[model samples]
Target: MAEDDDIAERRLAFGRAFIGALPHARALGMTLVDLTEGRAVMEMPYDARLIGDPETGVIHGGAVSALMDTCGGAAVMAHAQTPAGTATLDLRIDYMRSATPGRAIRAEAVCYHMTRSVAFVRATATDGEEGRPVASATGAFTVERGR
Candidate 1:
């Protein structure tokens, strides 16, 4: 039990550090909110600079995509069988609605499947609205096993 807890702690720490090291993640003000086995949650505070439309005050779809991609990678890294590093191979995001102004966006991702060389993830982004997501994504990531 103690060993498993220690492993989880170390993985979580690594996930945080990995996110902190990304230049884009930092620029977007992304924070790793949670990391557990095969799952991760990240948040990005609403920033005026990230607004796509000056009139609507809505955040850019690009920013939301970055958040989801980053969150997906974090989920892959949190998986028990994951390797030393991972990279995005492909990601498909579907936008459902614009994020509400002044509300931070949260993204949750789960690494649902893994092979020796790849991981599959699904993610959702929300902005304080229950059952309504700003965007949803499905992604495939490279799992670097031996490196």
Candidate 2:
């Protein structure tokens, strides 16, 4: 039991450090909300500076893309057999609607599959609502071995 607890603590610490080390994540105020094997959730508070259109105050699509990409990377790291590090190989995001001006956005990612060299992830960004996503994404990441 002690060993399990220690492992969990270490994993949480590592996840925190990983998110903290990214400049863009830090700039966007991204927080790791939850993490487990093969899954991760992250949140970014609404900020006026992130609004793409000053008139409408809609959060930029780029911000959503960045959130999903970071969340996907975190999901890959949460996978039980993840490699030393990972890099995005490809990412595609489809925006369904604009994020509400005053609402924080959250992204959830699942690493559904992994190979020796690649990991596949699906992710969604939403304004804390069910079924109404601001955007959805699918991504491939390169799994670096033997760091």
The estimated TM-scores of all candidates read: 0.93, 0.94
Against the true structure, candidate 2 reaches a TM-score of: 0.94
Full-model lDDT for every candidate: 0.93, 0.93
Candidate number achieving the greatest lDDT relative to the actual structure? 1
lDDT of 1 by residue, 1-147 (tens): 999899878877888899999999999999999899999999999999999999999999999999999999999988889677899999999999889999999999999999998999999999989899989999999999774
For 37-76, candidate 2 gives per-residue lDDT tens digits of: 8899999999999999999999999999999999999999
Backbone clashes under 3 angstroms, per model? 0, 0
How many backbone overlaps does candidate 1 show?
Answer: 0
Question: Which portions of model 2 show Cα errors greater than 4 Å?
Answer: 1-6
Q: Please give the lDDT score for candidate 1.
A: 0.93
* C-alpha root-mean-square deviation, each candidate: 1.4, 1.4
The true-versus-predicted C-alpha distance at residue 142 of model 1, in Å, is 1.0
lDDT (0-100) at residue 4 of candidate 1?
Answer: 83
Worst 10 contiguous positions by lDDT, candidate 1: 77-86
